[model samples]
Target: MNGRPVRVVENLNHALHESMLADSRLYVLGEDIADPYGGAFKATRGLSQANPDRVITTPISENGIVGVAAGLAMAGDAAIVEIMFGDFAGLAFDQLLNFASKSVSMYGRPHPMRLVVRCPSGGSRGYGPTHSQTLLKHFIGIPGLSLFEMSPFHDNRAVLAHMLGLGEPCVFIEDKVLYTRRMAGDGQVDDLFDYGFLGAGDTAPAHVYTEAHGDVDCLIIAPGGMAERALAAMRDLLLRHEISCRLVVPSRLYPVETDALLDAARHAAHVCVVEESTAGGTWGAEVAHVLHERLWGRLRRPVRLVHSADSVIPTAVHLEREILVQADTIVEAVLADLRGEGSPV
Candidate 1:
């Protein structure tokens, strides 16, 4: 839809610029986000230079940053807070949970808290434990707080615009690795796979990519960051094993809409969820539960969840690889589940 294929980071930067130009009341608050530095991943690049007064660089305080954004949002202004590392978002839990989320419905009248906390998350790079973690699961189920992930299929411009228009607080999770990956444009992923949307055009819908012309044998559900891995596995399953697999990548994580998911998964014999988060109390687990309930008695086997090992992420590249979910992990999980080797949930 543009001159050249842009990366996720560029799309985000463009979105921020367009949003700033459209709305004078919007402000960007973050640490080391101003000027020459741009941001940790350059998602806010050129923003400070373009809008000096609106783009503010703050101290190393996640809580303070979010709190100030919330205050600004309450005053009828839109505020976007950028958390350099997704792990550090835990420091702002109180501000998000008690203040921003509740302010929407706690008061007699609904206060439009046009606040969006953009988190650069997920692991693949050797950023170590403190820097590389997907902590969005902790913020799930919080009232009035919507969760979103940046995907190649969905335009970041549309995502940012939608979040600002929601008039509510939202946590936008950006996979650190996805920043450099080329985004899919014109509904074209590649020559092998075809892409389509399952839900309404306006809202965030699950992106379905598949090579299968007939019924798919397996349906794999994953977030944006995990899309690459899911695709890799999808390719391996189709080419090496002759198995038809459909990959569904969703932009919205929490408060997940299941109508599209159920429609896509009902035909598949097996459903598998892949995530970078460690096993247990994960978004994948929640999805598995939902699939079990909705597709009960219609499925061939229980849903399988593929995730990282339940341990602290290591710094060494090889060690970290072992702990995190990889493309091979997904392929193995799908094969195992198909063979009836995966135990019941």
Candidate 2:
């Protein structure tokens, strides 16, 4: 695939613009999304100029904005509402978990809650606690909501375009730190993972990075942003410790497509789950539990979960680094487990 040089931010902008052009029912709504400001992260730069009638700038009320989008979806229009920051999702929880989530299921007739909530998530750039939390875990258990995290190596444009047609409520998470980073394909460097479907179904695409034919000692599962560090750690593990590993970066966070994850783990000697959200009752924990429950008898070791500190992320650059998971941190965890220094399953 001859892919062009695309930054994460540009991918988002392209997806929004292209989807708007393709569908007349699609509308973009959020605070400071119009031109001049574009958005808090400029993901909607030229959208307002392209479609003045549909690109709306709303007042600072997450609940009100989401409620309005839900209503529009109920009325048969596809609405993309940006929550500005993941931390602000709390303000709209009632609207999301109550109405948007259960609309289709509650009514016997398919409601098609075609509302896509774009959340700028994850910490980086020292944006402070209130603005920088990875709160995707909070919405993971919602029965009818689909959750997605953009990976640098994946084609976000294609994924977003497809999601626009699914007619389901989706939480599209855009990493703040990834906005500036160029996506991993430029006709030079090969994509770190072989992207494909996990099973016979249309679940989220599963990624397999490392040797294609042989078994991997460790199966590292991580979200998109956290996969960056996980890749680094995997490489370090290979070079330093001679531990062969395969990394699986999932695009879908909620309803985690488990076919490939379980398939990969069946061959691995150990399994590790990494995430950016704070530890304790996180999405990573759920993955760990499932892996253990399914592969407990066949697994060689306990599934380790490496996540961020369970406290408010500090604004101080140095302190923030200490709180968040780094490549070295993941390396240490994998190394310790592989070396038999940690507990077994």
Tens digit of lDDT per residue, candidate 1, span 1-345? 657689888888999999999999999999999989999888888999899999999999999999999999999999999999999999999999999999999999988999999999988899999999999789878989999999888888888898898889999999999998998867667777878777666345655566433568999999999998899888999899998888888877888878878887887889999999987788888888888998988999888988888888998999999999999999999999988896534
Score every model by TM-score.
0.96, 0.93
Model 2, residue 243: distance off in Å is: 1.4
lDDT of 2 by residue, 305-325 (tens): 888877888999999999898
Tell me the whole-model lDDT of each prediction, alpha carbons only: 0.88, 0.82
Q: Pick the candidate with the highest lDDT.
A: 1
Minimal lDDT window, size 10, model 1: 205-214
Pull out the clashing pairs in model 2: 302-345
